[model samples]
Structures are given as C-alpha cells and as structure tokens.
Target: MRRIFILIIGIAVLYSCRNKQTESNNIVKAIAQDTLSKTVAGTADVGDVSPKNDETVKLIQKQLKVLLKNDLKSMTNEDRYFYYEAFDLNNDKKDEYFVGFSNSYFCGSGGCSGYILNHDGSVINSFSVTDFPILVTTDSSEKFYNLLMKSGGLFHLVKMKNGKYPSNPSIEEKWKGEVPKESTKVLDIYEKKLEKYSF
Candidate 1:
C-alpha cells in the first residue's frame, strides 16, 4: 500500500511539473506572437525647403530608395517604403535629412525598423521602436531622435549621439553615468546603425 501511495505521489508531481512547463511555454509563445503582430505605419512629410531646390529633393529620394533597398533585401516578405524629410533641426542655415521606413513584418502593437540618413548620403543612425513611435526628429545638434509610446504605459526618448553611430563607444568608462532606464533602446539603435554601416 505504501509503495502504491509513493508511486501515485510521484506521478502527481510529474504531471504538475509538466503542466507548469506547458503553461510557461504558452506564455512565451503568446508574447512572441503579440510582438510579431505589431506593424509600423506612418507618413513622412517634408516641410518647405528654403531656396526651393527640387534637385535636393530628387537627390534625397533617390539615395534613400537605394539605401533602403540594399538594407532590407535579405529580409523575407518585406513590403516597405522610405519616407524622406528635410528639416533644419539645429536651426543651422543648412537643412538636415531624415529618412524613415514603414515595416509590415511586425505590426499592430508597433514594432518597426528604420534608419536616419544624413544629408551627405551617409547613414548616421537607426532605430526599432517596439511601441508606436509618435515622433522621430532630430534635436538642436542634428542628433537623430525618436519618441516611443509603449502599450504598457511608458514613454521613452531615444537619442543617438552625433558621429557616434556605426561604431560603439570603445571605452567602457563612457558608460559611467547612472545607466539610463532606456539603455536597451539606446543600444539597439547603436547596434542597428553599426550593422548597416559596417556592410
């Protein structure tokens, strides 16, 4: 009788563990599905340009299309378009350029990938905001930036340092300040830009 009782207890424990494992897996799968369901969609309008140079607009459009085509070629079933804008972020006499892409792979809950192209045709920055990105603009220094509104009730601002993309800060000491709660977002931007530039 005691042997039978021990066997029953062992079976119960095994089934309990199995159920817990299945539940955990289900939760993980649900999160992954939710993330994949997010899509990024938006319009990028260019404000009036001084001197009204159509040549500059043409150049920006051509370069942006080429860059985006090359960058996203390997990804599967990609349907996206580049939205190019020219704005004077620093109030400098010269206008800076902004290029963003709409991603369909991850939709609905707001997961998308994009890059910021400098006026020189060099990519200065990039980002993937999981939440709905409300705004993407440069600061006074012409540093690329993004504002994300998360589903979980949080707001984040991701800023990339000037001339700092395409390469990581080699010195560990540079991370000295209190780590930004948005470190992951910052890091993702850096890494994406680096990957794009490295090729």
Candidate 2:
C-alpha cells in the first residue's frame, strides 16, 4: 500500500512539473507576439505627421496653377503629380507651404524642383535640384528656420539670406556633420499621397 502511495505521489509531481513548463512556454509566446504587434503598429504610423488642412492645399493648388501655367498647358495629366506639406518656419504662428515636384518635366538627373510659399499662396522661395526628406532645423537664419535638402547624393545646408532661401541647391554648401536631433522632415510623403493637379 505504501509503495502504491509513493507511486501516486511521484506521478502527481511529474504532472505538475509538466504543466508548469507548458505554462512558461505559453507566456513567452504571448509576450513575443505582443512585441511584434507593437513594432508593426509603430512602423505603419510613419510618414507625413502634419495635420491635413484642405484650405492650405487649395491655396497651394491656386498658386501652382499660376506658377506653372505654361508648363501645365504642355504636360499631360499623368505628369502633374506633386507633394506638399505645411510647416511653420518662422515664429510668426503661421505655417508656410513646402511643395515638391516629382514628374520628369520638373525633375532631372540631379533631383527635382521644390518651392516654399507663404500662407497667402505667394512664392517665398524656390529650390532647384532638390531631393525629398527636406529637413528643417531649430537653428534660424534671419528668423527663418534653416533647411537641409539633398541634391546629387549630398545634403546642402540652405539658410535664409536676404529674405530668401537659395534657389540652386547644387551650388550651396554641403552639410558634412551629423543631422541635428531637432530637425524635422517637413516634406516627406508617401507615393500614394502625392497630389494630382486637376488642371
């Protein structure tokens, strides 16, 4: 009888150990799955974090129609793609527009043309041979935020001079140092978000 009791106790102990091991494996798997889900959610949130304001977009379109009047007349609807974002460069509590062209007519081997417009749709600055991920740093030049644009595989530190950013980025000075932590990418957008000009 004692031998049978001993055997029963041994069986119970073995079963308990097996259950504990199974529970531990289940917990590990649950944690791993949770981590993976969070990573995917974070990645999906990346791209053009600024608020979508239809009024600002309309203003940009109005200005673009006049600015590219001649070019628009010659190009097809397929080549009318562009990207834009609104950001405050100065401390005036008003946002300025950043527009970039992606089509062949506006882009070349070096890069594409970008424009900065005021809240009233007036062109404030124009940039040529510019690439995306336009970085705006905390440092200001003449009360306007400094810009970092890529052209020809190099980054240019374009500063506001005499109330205007440089029109030609290829001729500007290159930024050799690391990018500033406070720099904000004001113009980066997904391909699907590119605005198609109705005109």
Best candidate, lDDT: 2
lDDT of each: 0.44, 0.79
**How do the residues 1-199 of candidate 1 rate in per-residue lDDT, one tens digit apiece?**
9999999999999999999999999999986665444311112222321233566556655765566566456545444434444554444456555444445643334444555556666666554543323333333223433333232334443344555332211211122234333211221322233111111
Best TM-score goes to which candidate? 2
Error of 1 at 149 (Å): 7.5
TM-score of 1: 0.40
Residue clash pairs of candidate 1: 37-107, 38-106, 38-107, 38-108, 39-106, 39-107, 39-108
Q: After superposition, how far is residue 126 of candidate 2 from its true place, in Å?
A: 1.3
Candidate 2 is scored at a TM of: 0.72
Candidate 1 shows a clash count of 7
Pairs clashing within candidate 2: none
